[model samples]
Target chain A: MRKSIAIDMDNVIVDIETNWINWYEKEFGVKIEREELLGKPEDEAFPDPAAALSLIYKTGFFRHAPIIEGAQEALLKLQEHYDIFIVSAAMEFPNSLPEKYDWLNEHFPFISWKNIVFCGDKRIIDTDYLIDDHLKNLDFCKGTPILFTASHNVNVTKHKRVNNWNEALALLGLH
Target chain B: MRKSIAIDMDNVIVDIETNWINWYEKEFGVKIEREELLGKPEDEAFPDPAAALSLIYKTGFFRHAPIIEGAQEALLKLQEHYDIFIVSAAMEFPNSLPEKYDWLNEHFPFISWKNIVFCGDKRIIDTDYLIDDHLKNLDFCKGTPILFTASHNVNVTKHKRVNNWNEALALLGLH
Candidate 1:
């Protein structure tokens, strides 16, 4: 059987930072620089954290997130070598469930519904490898953990790191 | 740390059979007896399988499914001993995602969103025990499988069986 890899949806494949930042700027009428967000979580990066984080509760926030550059091509190549499951922690925002499903359907049509998981705790997931941006998830994972680079997780060095989709493909020997 | 248990939604905690049967009777003007549905899957149990199954796609089908008898009490008791996760194969019906979350919130209020998982495949779940009505889920489970009795699965005997919530509690050594 091919080894299975659980890939996180947010910062790993979907460029949620860009979408969230744009929404934050549009709603708050402030164009925050990327440097301000570096080394800090999304909530803490903003002057008013709760107000900025509230944008996630908006209906189309998750659905409209831009796909990471080269994610589609990298994922297609990864699919040939491994069983890929797009795992997202969407239970916290119940509204994001269907939106995430539609987003995946529209963008990654190659991934079947059977391979998508909207879950709460990633610790319950058992796979050969887990690719994620959160150290909390990787700390408890039973499989090999590959840290996907995100502004919030730049300082975390406990797991193998991949700076981008290209680096991920290279690390996994896909290219 | 507590040993974790993964519990199925349909036919286990939420009685989908009664809801679907009631829906079919209302739509087709023909009542389906419980005996007729015995030993048969939901779709195959009906005359027009497609039409009957289509009710699942209807807006509020999953949202209104009645909770199983003694489930709330038994689950509450079980929660004290084991980490309980409500795992459901909900990705197939994208519309059912939020509805199922609402249903669980209304009926099983004690279960936090942190313990709920909506996914395509049960094989990815890692827990100490899985209480489910389907054998396909059990077949791939890496943990102990406890088969919950359902009309369609009465003939299945490959796993340890519990006829009702009372039996399930007794088998688990709970009062």
Candidate 2:
């Protein structure tokens, strides 16, 4: 049986840190060092985090978000060995649904629509492995949790961590 | 607190029974009366159920599927009193994701994208009420199950059956 892998989209496959930081800096007119966000929840990393995060809920943010370095290549390689599902807590931003779908279609065309899951809660997902950037999602996963490194999650140490796509591929034995 | 109602998409909202019957006749060149399909799972209703059902997996079938009579009106009215979520087993048909999303956008624009759940298994859903045509979905639901009468499920007597949208509205005291 092919092992199934449920991958989170925002910080895992897509590079939200770079885009968010740039957007936040330009929008807020405040310089935010990347390290300032380390080990902090996104809301706590900045003043008025709700307003800052709401920018992501806008129409074009997710559609134009940059793909993390090596994510496309690693995911394509991973698809050959496992059932790769792009699971995201997209309901938080209702507009992200079509944007995320279009983003995946553009960047990860090889992934079938069946493998894409847009849901609110991660606890409901049952898979062989879950790769997520948030501890909240990983904490409830029924499968082995591989923490994908993100600025907000760097301090989390409960699960095995993958700093980059190469590390993820190696950990999954895809390397 | 507004009660959450998770509504199934296929027969409960979109009229798949009529569309499937029409498509089955054109593709298979065999007339299948609606009554003949009663009480039978979709696949078992035909000689080559796999092939018959595969037609539904095609691109246009779901996008072009007609809405169940009164579903739109009923849902609009229900939205006034309850939190409505459109939950469908869309992952089973890979091609239906975008189609279903677009269909909802066109027909049920009042429903926010946050309420749309495209998932494989319905067991994970947490809601107050589940309105679905499939007994398999309702059997595992954590809430009151309202069986929406579909041709395949007309014989089902296990749950509170609502034969039409008017009946459904009346049962929920929305009428």
Candidate 3:
């Protein structure tokens, strides 16, 4: 069986969180409170964090997101070996799942929409490389977690911190 | 027979002109002469429009391009009836085509590198609905040319203008 890879859409595929944070915060009437969202346990993070993720995604903020530095190059290298699955927790919220799916279809056509899984909790899904930024979701990975660095992560430094797609590839030993 | 629709990438798929105007004025010391670029014949309006387009596309400008307002809804709807080809004159220039294609893949996965048609003059390709912003390329299509609206083209009333995608659907009768 081939190793499957789970990649996050927001901060990893593109810089959605950083760029849309201000606009979304203004519109939603609440702060993202990155530390709190990432620090909470998965059970507590549910509904609120997922709600926040879906809320931001519903505003159509990720439509024009800039791809993370070296994202395409990194994905290209990764695609050669592993089964690239863009399993996004971004669109798991209600009312906008289909819209987010359409958006995903527009951005990345290489993976069939079938491979693009959406769920509130990522730990339930199994994959080889879980490339994501949130700490709450990283705990359930049966495989190694490739941590994507962001502005709002806690001080737990056990996992690999990748600055860009290039660093991600290097950490995966694909470079 | 499938009616091939060869659309432009820069403005057709995403708004590349507005993004470049800002870059050109600051870096190249050239204010965007839109009237000069679109109105006059390509030879007269843009003595080196091809070169200029190549320069902008190479700068990774396509990575952040907003899908042209009408083109987005229009392209998705259009994808159903015809074999849509992204025939961009911008990527025909040297050293920029690969990155430009990659950029398209990042934003609009519906358009793969293989389906994209590159030409100095779109007149060479065969297509029905040539949804384009540039007037020069419109000459290539024997079918109806659905004009995507833009800032520089506020005054050109000769061609049909579409600000939203639904109007594009109506124009192509894809609705």
Candidate 4:
């Protein structure tokens, strides 16, 4: 049987961190320094984290997020060997449902709608491997968890970490 | 921590079996006998199971599905004691996404949009209790699995069974 792989959307597939930073700078007139954000919560790293974070949850935000470097090529290659599923914690923002759907349809049209999951909690996902940036999502995975490095999750080291799509593809033996 | 409950939407909460049967009759001009369907796959019981099943995947089918008797009341009452999430394997039918969302908004408006999950595989769901009609869904659950009795699952005996919403309520100590 082909091993099932569940890939997260935010920092793993799409560069939401860059989008957040750019949106914050454009909206709040404050360019947050990366060093200050290291090892700090979003609310602590910025003047108004809630407002800044809320911008991404609005309609059309996910549709506009730039794909992570090498993600498209790596995912296309990975799709040949594994049953890839895009598992996103999208219920927190109801507006994200259609937007995420459209985004996936545009970028990863090869991924069937049956492989896309819009969920609230990651604990319920059962797969052979999970590639995600958040420890909270990886902590309870029944399968092997590979941490995709992100700015906020830089200090988390409980699981095997992959810094980029090349590393992730190699870790999964896709390369 | 509050115990979390994951509820299946199809036959458990909404009467999809009945709707399918009714639709099959209307579309094919052939009335299917309930006995012919017992313990058999839909394909075995129908002239064209693919076509019959495909009707339910259309955009409007889910929006018009009748709620399982007492489901709305039981879920509402159960909501007072536990954190409830609707975990539906809806990604199999892409058109069902917006329809299911709209149906929940109209009927079970009390369920926050945050609590609704649309996914393909059920194995990824993690919760304290899963009330579902399929043994396939319950077989891999980490939590207590309460088999919500449906005609197709009537012969399944591996798990504790509840014939109706009242029985489900009683089993969960809500009665």
Q: Is the docking of candidate 3 incorrect, acceptable, medium or high quality?
A: incorrect
Report the C-alpha lDDT of model 3 over B72-106, residue by residue, as the tens digit: 56667777877776665542332344455566667
lDDT of 3: 0.61
Candidate 4 backbone collisions, by pair:
A124-B124, A124-B125, A124-B126, A125-B124, A126-B124
List the pairs of residues colliding in candidate 2.
Answer: none
Listed per candidate, the RMSD to the true structure in angstroms reads 0.9, 6.7, 14.9, 4.4
* Per-residue C-alpha lDDT of model 2 across residues A41-124, encoded as one tens digit per residue: 887787668867877866688888899999999999999899888888886765666788789889999887757778766765
Q: Which docking class does model 2 fall in? A: acceptable
How does residue A6 of candidate 3 score in lDDT?
82
Whichever of 1 and 4 has more DockQ, that candidate is: 1
Candidate 1 fraction of reference contacts recovered = 0.92
Regarding TM-score, does 2 or 3 come out ahead? 2
Docking class of 1: high
Per-candidate Cα lDDT values, in order, are 0.92, 0.85, 0.61, 0.84
Q: Give iRMSD, candidate 4.
A: 2.3
A41-95 in candidate 4: lDDT tens per residue? 5556667878887786666678888889999999899988888999998877767
Ranking by DockQ: 1, 4, 2, 3
Q: What share of the true interface contacts does candidate 3 keep?
A: 0.00
**Judged by TM-score, which candidate is best?**
1
Each model's number of backbone clashes? 0, 0, 0, 5
Residue A171 accuracy (lDDT) in model 1? 86
| Poorest lDDT segment (10 consecutive residues) of candidate 1 chain B | B34-43
